[model samples]
Target: MSGRQAVPSVRGKPGWLRRLDPLTKGIWLLCTGLAVMLTLSLTAQLLWYLVVLILAGTGAGWRLKQWRLFALWAMGFGLPLLLFQWLMLPVGGDEPLWQPFGSGGPALTASALELSAALTLRSMTLFASSIVYATTTEPRDVVVALTQQLRMPDKLAYAAAVALRFVPLLLAEAEQIRRAERLRRLTPVRGVGGRLQSARRMALAIVRSALRHVQDVSTAMEAKRFGSARARTHWRRVAISPAGWLFAAASIGAAAATLVYF
Candidate 1:
């Protein structure tokens, strides 16, 4: 099979990043997420916001396709932050409006409420940024970067990449099955029982679909000489550019400064 054109890879650009290595982008996102969470000053949070701006401007914002997904995550992480701000901060001070609930006889001030609002925004922003990372990155790219650059074993890395590739495919298939189930007159749930029944159907569909896709992918990979130690070549290789290192260094430096200060 000398010079046989290999099966086209689902790697490289996703019609979005235009050949931007997913691994590079993933590391940058990781750094940004860590920095945002640790940053006490909202100004610092805003600075990292520029990274997201650049990503969007470059058309890589296709990862942000699932903005609605962020709402659920925002509730999970941001709600707690809001609750933290509410319980810890007093609602009154010089401009006291009401009294603290128990123990301390301090007045709850408007300033404390204002602080909560800011904290809420910070939490939501952090969560939203995280969603962008998960949505944008294709797992195979990450595995390649780790294996090729970090000297990790290709066998292990490829295993990880294959696993990631199946997640979204399974999700899509499960969604399809759910619709099919609905068409079978088992959907459009109105009561608690109906909802529970729908959930059960969806869960079963996901499991079955995932198993089938796994088998298909495994067979296809095996047929294609994947996991071979015969030195397969990449037609489209991931190259680390000078820009990548610069981005990484700046992210690390910025994150470090924030942690030390705030």
Candidate 2:
């Protein structure tokens, strides 16, 4: 055998949505979130969420399995919140849909139900948009966009990039620590108090690991003279494609229309 490493094959072609610039996607996410927040009409909320669902589906290459996962997540997150909103909203007027206690007690009305549905849709729209941005945009691209396009300080941009890079690592490290503890056949903790104690142990271990990782990163950055200068050059450029600009314009326009019309 030759001393060569095999390159991994690329999967399916990246969709148009993924090809768009990270800044464009960020704009879309912001517009969608703002629209969700500004609109109280159920119809407007539904339309905004539908647009986000379409974008997410396109980004995922319209895979049925991915759509199923999105639906499952939407239902899981929205249903409980919807129920709680419907129960707690002090919306008066309209006929009571159902009175859990007595007639004199708090009652669910049509307006309350409508408002709850709108609120649930708003939450789901924001959640789905956030997932799209997080999954499609690379951390390095975010740093480039911030420093080069937005004219942000290199120190702040690099700090944001480091946070994005470290969060997943920290989570994986915590999982590994749990697995190592299990492999050692540690005493099984039971009951609420035992669970709290286990969590405390895990938290301490994670904190120590995080501190070590931070120190190593800081040392490396210092050796490289990172943030020593006011200006920096990137190895690669992140340019905004025509399609990305068009997408951003359309998203902003739709958000404006939704705000004004509904």
For model 1, how does the per-residue alpha-carbon lDDT over 78-104 read when each residue is reduced to its tens digit? 777775676678555456676656546
Global lDDT scores for all candidate models: 0.60, 0.76
lDDT tens digits, residue span 179-245, model 2: 6776776677679898788779889999998999999989999999987786787897999999899
Off by over 4 Å in 1: 1-18, 36-58, 63-140, 177-187, 224-231
Best by lDDT: 2
Number of the top-ranking candidate, with TM-score as the measure:
2
Worst 10 residues of 2 by lDDT: 1-10
Q: Which RMSD does model 1 reach against the true structure?
A: 7.9
Instruction: Tell me how candidate 2 scores on lDDT.
Output: 0.76
How accurate locally is residue 73 in candidate 2, as Cα lDDT from 0 to 100? 62
TM-score, candidate 2, is: 0.74
